[model samples]
Target chain A: MKLRVKYSGQLRTATRCGEEDVGWSPDRTLAELIAHLAERHAAGRPHLLSDSGAIRPSLLIAINDAAVMANEANATRLRDGDVVWLLPPIAGG
Target chain B: MEDTGQRSELDAAERNRYEWQLWVPDFGEAGQRRLKEATVLVSRIGGVGGTAALQLAAAGIGKLILAHGGELRLNDLNRQLLMTTDWIGKPRVESARRRLRELNPHVEIETIEANIDEGNAADLIGRADLVVSAAPLFAERLAMNRAAVQLGKPLVDCAMYDLEGRLTTVLPGRTPCLACLYPEPPPHWKREFPVFSAVSSTVGSLAAMEAIKVLAGFGEPLASRLLVFDLRNPCFETLPLRRRPDCPVCGPISRPAP
Candidate 1:
């Protein structure tokens, strides 16, 4: 399955790209996808996940424009052609 | 929330000064009255809070409680609109108060020489009907959020990073608070981020408008929605938001019936 991944704020700074297309297994939970990206972007790994391998609570993961909260990321399943948006929390006034 | 019940009547000068906005179909005399009665607390009068307070004053808000601590530096001149070059070494909130007063003398402005923190957040938020959380740190924003949620007042959270800005309105029990959105501060998040004046001002102005809508009950507030815009790509998007049931801060507040 092919998915479109979008990045904004610090995530864009880390990933060095606004967006990209990724081919992944069907029906993988959002957490798995985040882990996959963590592996792909080795330098940005720490920014994506915590020491416990949990997607950092501050990183907002949205599947198709609906934000998945920290407690729900593992339960959120993605499929072919889905759009995932990763936004690191920005508090700049 | 109880503040709306006591909307102040607009005087002749106020009505004349706000004549154009009074022409707005649903936001006529009543909306103007509501704005006239509102007292909003804007945290850290920087790029975002300064602009938000300016807009609110121009829109005839009755009072503004400006809270920000620190001396303005040359670097802040790029985006902190309320500050003047001459006031570089002065307090930022006082600058904001002076600028806002110059713009709308009819609107009362109060300046606080401190930033929002867990200790003072509740005390400051306690005095206002609404809040604009524009502090440059997660700790400050979350502090304001906890106070606003506990106080049952509306909060408009605004943020900017480089060319991107985002905003959301929190209606306490009716919507998800900031804690629900970002359970914890981002690992690498820092106080400083790239900012363009235009981007911060844009988000600030929009946040002010959202505050107006929430106060006057005229337009649809960004309740349960996040509006994100990136000037680099020139795109805007609204993403749906949900309340986290386990959100410790707002979890105990029962939602009112529709």
Candidate 2:
């Protein structure tokens, strides 16, 4: 269950890699994936989390192409083949 | 059917002009007619807004009002489709008005050369049925949101940050207003961030499509959700958005007026 993860805009600069293929997991949540990626890749720890360890409002998390509540980052369950995308503030028209 | 001569010929011309849309059954006579009679305001001729304006013009929107200011620069060409090297240092709105007219003579191009501020937002937006908030910054988007709420007009707000774009439809109190989603304008540094034309155009086209849907009364409106497009990986996402009861712009309005 490999997942294709993508980062866009300035978030790319922070993540270091625009694209990543992550090992598959069953019932993994978005937060777990980001944490895993931070450790696997040379990417710096996600600044998406605020000092309080909450997802920052300035960024957005989407599974397969839909936005999800940040507080539910880890709550939004992911399936074996799901694709989750993370993007930090750049512009939204 | 004796008078069918002129009517039949007109239908052929119309079909030829709108052949692409005509293929969509729902967008037949009524939709095409509505599009022909609709007026949309693209508040800025910047990256996303400019591209949206161009699509509107090419798609045969009956009337388009482009509001923008300042002289063009070489840098603006990256996403500002409305200008060319030949028109550098010239006024944006004026040049865009001419180019759009060339694309489709039928599109009535109007221009408001001044910037949209709290002072003139109402008057600027009052002329159109719907507003497209593609302004360069959040302050402009916020001002347009207020004007739309006051008029009960729908606003297609698009913003770009690098290769990512976020689009939200604001119907006053129906969904979250710009202020509800963003309490403040995120500071002027938001502009300091780099933007690519590819991302700008992506957001711009989506904004135009939303405006078309609203004008013609077809399809589902992104009323209570935000559409996020990340060109870096080509992912599209929509998140349900709730109206902020305390939103400064439309929080306490008697009704959304949408």
Candidate 3:
């Protein structure tokens, strides 16, 4: 499946993935996709995952336009032309 | 219709001050009167809240309750527009009040020099018809969310980092509160992050507009939707937000009584 991943905030600078689509195998879960992105973009690994190799709790994953909660993210599957937004919490006022 | 006449009449000065915006369709003198009668609370009047409060005052909101702690510092000048260089050592809320009052003397201005916390969240939020949660911490944001949910008031949540910003409107039982989006603060979250006045003000202005729409009953509001802007790529996306049925803050309140 082809997924278009949009990196938000500091993640964009860290990942260097701008306006490009990433390819992944069928039935790839949101967590696996994030892990794959972390692997591909080594600089963003720390931001995307924790030392325990889990998708960081702070990372917000939106499939299409609906936000997937942290607990449900691993079970959520991606399909062709899925648009995923990797939003980090931006607390600065 | 019973109280329409009593509620919709705007004074001569108000009519003149909001002349340009009064031209907006569905938001004529009646909308202006709604704005004149509304009270909005903007917590932590810094980059985001300060701009939100300024726009609210410009729109002639009846009362603005501005809350923020600490004296201004040189570092805050880049984004805290309400704080001028001369007022560096002064309290931020006082400075914000002075500037907002200068802009719209007819609008009532109230200031509190303390940031939102458990001690004062209920009292502060209870006093306003609407709330703009521009505080820089999740704890403060969650406090505001809880208070808003409990009080059944609308809240506009705004935040920014570097060139990105996100906004969502919470209508208590109707839309998702901040806690529903992030059950707990992100592990990587920090108290301070990269911020630009341009980005903060952009979100702040949008938040203020959301508040105006909610108060004046004109344009469509961002309720149950999250709008994210990435200024680096100049991209804007509005995503649908769902209320978490299990959300501790809003879930129980939305449940039907047995």
Each model's DockQ score: 0.84, 0.24, 0.64
lDDT of 2 by residue, B61-171 (tens): 778988887889988887788888899988999889988888878788889887788998998788888899987666777788888888888899888886678887887
Task: Please state the i-RMS of candidate 2.
Answer: 3.9
Docking class of 3: medium
User: Candidate 2, after superposition: displacement of residue B220 in Å?
Assistant: 1.4
User: By how many angstroms RMSD does model 2 differ from the true structure?
Assistant: 5.8
lDDT, candidate 3, B1-258, per-residue tens: 122566557768878988999899998877888887888999999999999999999999989999999999999999998888999898999999999989999889999989999889999899999999999888999999999999999999999988889999998888888888877776666777788899999999999999999998878888888898888878898988777788889998764343
For candidate 3 chain B, the 10 contiguous residues with the lowest summed lDDT are: B1-10
lDDT of 3: 0.86
Residue ranges of candidate 3 with Cα displaced over 4 Å:
A18-20, A42-47, A56-58, B1-9, B255-258
How does each model score on TM-score? 0.96, 0.76, 0.92
Better of 1 and 2 by lDDT: 1
Best by lDDT: 1
